[model samples]
Target: MNNFTIYLATLLCLLASKVVGQETFETRAKNIAAKIETITKEEKSALKEEVEAVNNQLEKGSITLEQAENKKKVLAEARAINIEARVGKEQENLKNLVQEKVDGKISESDTIKKSNQLILKWEKGDKKHIAKNEKRTTSQFVFAAGLNNLVTDGKIEDSDFRFLGSHFYELGLTYNSRLAQNSNFLHAKYGLSLMYNNLRPTDNQNFVINGEQTNLETNPIHLKDSRFRNVYLVAPVHLEFDFSGSETKGNKRYFKTHQNVRLGIGGYAGFHLKSKQVLKFDDSNLEATEKSKGDFNTSTFIYGLSSYIGYKETSLYVKYDLNSLFKNNTINQNNISVGIRFDLN
Candidate 1:
C-alpha cells in the first residue's frame, strides 16, 4: 500500500481503539489523559529524530559540534514547550468534556461524534488563525482598456481621429485608504500608472510635422494602416465614495470597500514618455512598414480628469486630457477615452 493509505489506516486504528459504548464520565476523562501522554510521546519522538539529523550533519562536517549542540538544545526546548501546550489543551478539553457529561449537555453518542470530528480534522489541515488587528490601507491592481479618440475645441463630432479604431490602455497599482476611522463611505485612492493612447485618422491620412505645427495629410501611398501613439507615466488620485458599509466584530468596526456601488472622481498628472507614428502600405507591389519616433510638437507634460462609476471591482471609466494634443495646431485637440476599469484587490 502507498504511504497515504498506510497513514490513513493508522489513524483509523488509533480512533477505533478510543471508541467505547456508554462510557461514564471517569472513562472519558481517562481517555483524554491518555491522549495527553500520547502528545508527549509524539513530541519527544520528533525531537529525537531532529537531534539525530543534527548529529549526522556534525559528522559530515556540515555543522560544527558547538552548532549541533546549540541546535539540539533549541529543538529540545521547542519540543518540550509543544508537549506542554498540547497536553494542557487536552487537559482543558477533558475538564469541559467531563463537566458537560455531568450537566447532561453531552450524551453517550457524542463521544463517537467527537472522535469522528477529530479524525476529520487530522485528515484536513487545521484552519488558519487570523489576528485581531486590521490594516487601514489596502492596495489593488488597476487595469483599463477601451476606445480612444480626440476632441477638437471641445467638440467630439469635429475630431479628425476615428472613434472606432482608436484605443487606450492603462495599467497600474493603487492604494485605497479609509478617510474615517469608523466609516467605509469615503476613501483616498492614489496610484502610479502607465497610459497608452493610440489615435488612427479617419481617412487614409498620416501626421505631418510642419515648421511649427503637426497636421494630418493624405498619404502619398494607399495607406493600409496609420497610427499615432503616445505613452505617459502618470500619478493619479481620486476621492472614492464606497457604499459598501461596515461590520462590527468584538468592539471593533471594520470598513469594507469595493463590495457594492462605488464612485471615483480623480485626475492625473505626468510627463510624456514617448510619441511615435506607424504606417504600413504597399510599396511597388511589396508590403512595406514605416515607423517614426519624435515629439511631433505634442505636449511635454500631461494632466487629465478621470472618473468611474460602478459596482464592485469593475466600473465604467472615462478620462479627458486637459492639455492640447499638439502645441501649435490651428485648432487645439485633446485626447479622450471611454472604457471599462477593473480594480483587483
Candidate 2:
C-alpha cells in the first residue's frame, strides 16, 4: 500500500509540472505580442510627427511641395524598415524563449521576469531613435603640428629660419554647421585657436633688434640653439565640402562629416599674444640657457589663408600669413606652414 501511495504522488506531481509549464509558455507568448504592438505604435507615432513637420515646412515655403513629397516618402520608407526590423528582433526573442523551454533552461518561477527583461533589452538596444535625433551642428577638437618657416619677399628659398628645425603647433575647438537643411555636402566650420610658431635660425644666427628693424645676425658666442617663438589667438572660418554619404534611420537622415574625403578653404585673423626667444650655448665649459621675452618687432596683428584636403579625420594642411612678420623691416617676411591636421570628434 505504501508503494501505491508513492506512485500516485509521483503521477500528481508530473501533471502539475506540465500544467505550470503550459501556463508559463502562454503568459510569455502574450507578453511578446503586447511588446510587438507597443513597438509598432511608437514608430508609427514618430512617423506621423515627422510628416507633420514636413508639411509645415512646405506651408512655410521653406521647401517646395515636390521636395516635401519626396521627404515624406523617404521618411515613410525608413519608418517602415525600422518597424519591420524591430518586430523581427522581438520575434527572434520569442523563438529563443521557446527553445530555452524545450531545453529545460527556463524555470516556471523566473519565466515572467525573463520575458520582461527581454522586452527591456529590446527597448535599450534600439539605436534607430538615437540616429534619427542627430543634431544640425557638431563640434570637434582640432590639433595641428608641422614644419614652420617664413617666405621672405615672396620667396621660400630665401628663408632665414632652418627648414627642419622650425615648427608650428595649433590647438582649438571648432564647430561645423550644415549649409543646407537637407544636404550635408557643404558646411561652415568656424572656431578659435591658439597658435605657436617657432623659428630656429640657421648658420649660428640670432635675431637682433636694431632700432625699428629685427634682423638675423651671427652670434659671437657660437650658439648651439637659438629659437624665437610667436603666440597668436586666432579665429578661423572655412567652407568645407564633405563627400561622406548620409545614413537614414527611422524618419530622419544624418550626415556624419569627416568620415570620408573632404576639402576645406578658409581664412583666419587675430592678434599676436606674445613673443619670446630662447638661447642655449656653451660658456667656459658650462651649459648656459637664456630666455628673453619681447615683441622683437613682430607684427601685433595676424591674418592668414588656410586650406586642407584629407580623408576621414586626418588631412594635409597648409596656411600662409598675409601680414608681414615684423612691424618695421627692410624686407617683408611672412610665416608659412605645412603639416598634418586632425579633427577629433
Candidate 1, 57: how far from true, in Å? 58
- Relative to the true structure, candidate 2 reaches a TM of 0.63
The C-alpha TM-scores of every prediction are 0.62, 0.63
What lDDT tens digits, residue by residue, belong to model 1 across residues 150-211?
88888899667888889988756688998887777889999767688999996789999998
Task: State the lDDT of candidate 2 residue by residue for 133-163, as single tens digits.
Answer: 3666876656687899999998999677899
Error in Å for residue 128 of model 1: 9.1
Model 1 scores worst on lDDT over the 10 consecutive residues at 125-134
What's the CA error at residue 6 for candidate 1, in Å?
45
Which candidate has the highest TM-score of all? 2
Off by over 4 Å in 2: 1-133, 283-286
Best by lDDT: 2
Model 2 score (lDDT): 0.77
